[model samples]
Target: MNIYRYEENPIITPADIQPYHKGFQVIGAFNAGVAEYNGETLLLLRVAEQPISDDPNKVLAPVYNTGTGKIDLVELDRKDERYDFSDPRVVRDVTQNATFAYLTSISYVRIARSKDGHRFTIDNEPFIYPSNEQEIFGVEDPRVTQIGEDYYIYFSVVSPKGIGESMVSTRDFSNVTHHGMIFSPDNKDVLIFPEKIGGKYYALHRPTMKSIGTPEIWIAESDNLLYWGNHKHLLGLRQGMWDSGRIGGGAVPIKTDKGWLELYHGATMEHRYCMGAVLLDLEHPEKVIARSAAPVLEPEADYEKKGFFGDVVFSCGVVVDGDIVRMYYGVADTSMACAELSLQEILDSLVYE
Candidate 1:
């Protein structure tokens, strides 16, 4: 798989962004949603911030206090046996059975503008932060779909209630209208189609399973974009292959003559993430036609293999100009990077079903 990585990779990083408030520090600036507004390339970045704490005896977390409408820090004693520090992202309290009990960092969607697609200027404030109880944990991995005059945005909402997907729409990016949670708990990686098909809207989502099945891409159709139904399992993991563990929708699926080209991320049993391509029927996106055997883009660079979550190449969006596919992706869950691939090359690499 030939990929032309930007010479100045990691166009945005934690060090490049300032903390939203004083006691906090930016730890990650990645998993951005790509779009074009006013002839400028736009990236809706997921900026993660963690509280400053040097004490070895204490672990600090960020929580959105719904009552006060502000994020407050929650500190726990490291000596406490009940605090499960297994996942670096969350300080899970084994005593409680509920998720989103405590998160190590809180993320918000911020804008980063670029003229040349590689060089970006990070914005000061968050474009979309945790505004409701459902977003108490944080808003993350946003996917934007432009239809007519409106840009419809949907993202993952993490909270004590459960991890779900929510929707928001904007035209100028200055103002937004929140449409509340579209998909319920334990479901995320939702991507709405750029346009409707067969007089209805389409979407791709991932529903994580606990006992019944594995996480795979699923297709859903809606009449008004809010009320969604007719969900069908679209893509499943290929056992013993690159995407054997789990898979999720990445980037808004690009429309091509070949099919609805979807660049998705898949992880191994070891949690190593890589990017691959799949082709779906344009008229019937639920019917996938082709997919990659090996990853088109994987964690190979030193920067991609080391940081917050190492060996990961996850993306939320891409920009397709003519035959060139410019992919804006997150590396190691720490920084934003860009790479270019041939549209024909990616399509040719796929195995037709």
Candidate 2:
């Protein structure tokens, strides 16, 4: 595929975002949801922030307490033998056999606006944060779909209950209505189609199964957009291939003459993430028309191969303007970047067999 990355790649970083609260430091600003609103390009960025501590030996995790209605910082001693801090993102308690863990940083969505697609000015305050028990840990990886005048936001809500999909809608970006948790635990990467299909709204979701099942993409339909049903498996992990580990939905599926063009992310068992495309039947979205035998985009750049997490390029949204498709993606779980591909070029690259 002929992919052209922006010269000013890594467009948004932690430095662009201010901490949501005092005494906290912004760690990452990535995985943003893209949209064109009010004659400007908008990015709903996932900003990760962590509590800053003077003591180097102590690791602090910011947690939102529902009862207290405030964020509490939990201090974990680095020398503590009861926990494992092998991963920079999470701290696992050894006593529970690593069954329990907490994120080093709490993530929330913030807005960044740009007159041109490349340069952006981020808002000092967060656009969305953890407000209820369902999102006590944090809210993450948002995908926005504009339906009529209303834009629906689908994101992952993390808590003790497990990660699930939640819905919120906005029109003017000033006022938003939370529709609560729409998908149950252990599900995420949910993206809704911009319009109704067969007189019902449709969505693509990924539900992770711990035992016998691998992480795969699934499709569902709903009449009211809140209550979804008629679930069907859409795609599965290709063993020994680039996406052998897992696969999930990315960007809102782009509608075209050929089919619904979906730009998604896949990973190997080695944890290397790449972006690829798949074409689904327009009328019956559950049917896969074509899939990319090779990744359309990969983690080849130094910025993508080294960061908070390495060897990853995951996209949350894409904007189609005529023949050009601008994809906004997160690099190595740390910062935001943009790349462009011809819409027809991607369709031609798909393997039918």
TM-score of each: 0.98, 0.98
Instruction: Report the lDDT of model 2 for residue 327.
Output: 94
In model 2, the clashing pairs are none
Give the TM-score (vs. native) of candidate 1.
0.98
Indicate the residue-level lDDT of 352 in model 2: 91
Alpha-carbon runs more than 4 Å astray in model 2: none
Q: How close to the true structure is residue 294 of candidate 1, measured as C-alpha lDDT?
A: 91
How far off is residue 316 in model 1, in Å? 0.6
After superposition, candidate 1 runs with Cα above 4 Å error: 96-100
| Candidate 1: tens digits of C-alpha lDDT, residues 169-259 | 9999999998999999899999998998889999999998977999999999999999999999999999899899999999898989988
lDDT of 2: 0.92
Candidate 2's displacement at residue 141, Å, is 0.5
